[model samples]
Target: MKLDRTAIEALLPHRAPILLPTEVEADPATRSGRALIRLDANARIFGALAQPALAHELLLEAAAQTFGIVIGACPPEGGAAAGAEGRHLLLGFDEVEFGPAALDGGAPFELEVALEQTSGPVHVARFSAEQGGAQVARGQLQVFNG
Candidate 1:
């Protein structure tokens, strides 16, 4: 399924400037997904910096959001939405590798995430970010579902 900004906003708690994904593509069955984020001046991380670039933290957030899209798409076993009540928390990052910064040129990037494992409320996913078909970052995110 393809989700626009409004639909994405409805599924996620993040608001604009921080809600990075412009669009999301997800498979509820496989629990894998990809999200597109177009970096512009409006991105909060840019602030007032003359030359803005995609920070590692922001990339991580994007990855987490992408994962959130997947989780939100596939509700829990009982049909309860994941993070519907803002209970999901990013527990940590593992083996995170940062690449070249995405400058403020209205360039679009893609974040892809796949479910790696789940231990109770802790969900682990592997994620990667790419721009112009080149990898910009990769990491594993651990999210705690409440």
Candidate 2:
């Protein structure tokens, strides 16, 4: 299920997308997605995603997971028609991190991501996951015209 540039563009809002390198870490659960890494002004890189650690064959997997998602043509305005103004496009992984066992007490873990339109000018967007009243994880992805 490798999506080429055309397929990705058709599925996303922006004509082009900034596909970062695929990163994966060992987890007890089988959930899978990419890890977002960021660097500060002092040139220190930080992991935006969080994963639980276990003692096993420590290894990092490098591949796109089955959890990535892309949504185009967002819902319309409040109680309005389908073809309303200001549509939204979203792209990110649904579940990221995996192994043979579930995360802490069978609860799903969340990862953070950042997206941007970075060709000439860099415009950014951020996303976070929440359940009930607690925050879970976050992610980001970039889109552009083809």
Candidate 3:
């Protein structure tokens, strides 16, 4: 199912400024989805969040939040650890590759992702961040149920 902005916000723990999933199209049955992220560097509060809008780094958090949406679709009896709490943690990253800038000025990008339940409460999510028809970054994120 495709989640609108309202639904996406409901499934994610993050809020504006830090919230990266602007739009997400997900298939809960497969624990896969694509998220459109538009970073707003200006949304910072009192310069706390001020920094260069780095797409490669921010893409990782976006991918994790996107995976959370699809994970919400799994039933309690299923292997998904997220359950109904909508609580999950991004543990770490692995095999991350930083590529040339797909575009300057922190252009919006879409990340296609798939998640696998590796073990109890542990999940591995793979994602490809693309912008301007070119890939900006690709990596796997380690996640676990909260």
Candidate topping lDDT: 1
Model 3, 46-119: lDDT tens digits are 55543255545667777777777777755444454545744777799898886776444346778898985568
Error of 1 at 64 (Å): 1.0
Overall lDDT per candidate, in order of appearance:
0.77, 0.28, 0.71
**Candidates ranked, most accurate by TM-score first:** 1, 3, 2
- Candidate 3 positional error at 121, Å: 1.1
TM-score (C-alpha, index-matched) for candidate 2: 0.23
Q: Write the residue-wise lDDT of candidate 2 on 40-100 in tens digits.
A: 1111113322323421101111012112222122222244432243333223233333344
TM-score of each: 0.83, 0.23, 0.80
Candidate 3 residue 92 Cα shift, in angstroms, is: 0.4
lDDT value, candidate 2, whole model: 0.28
The candidate, 2 or 3, that scores higher on TM-score is 3
Question: Model 3: clashing residue pairs?
Answer: none
Backbone-clash count (model 1): 0
lDDT of 1 by residue, 1-146 (tens): 88888888887765555888889998776778999876563356546522254466677878988888778876665667654534578888999987765543367788899988888888899999988888888989999987
Alpha-carbon runs more than 4 Å astray in model 2:
1-71, 74-123
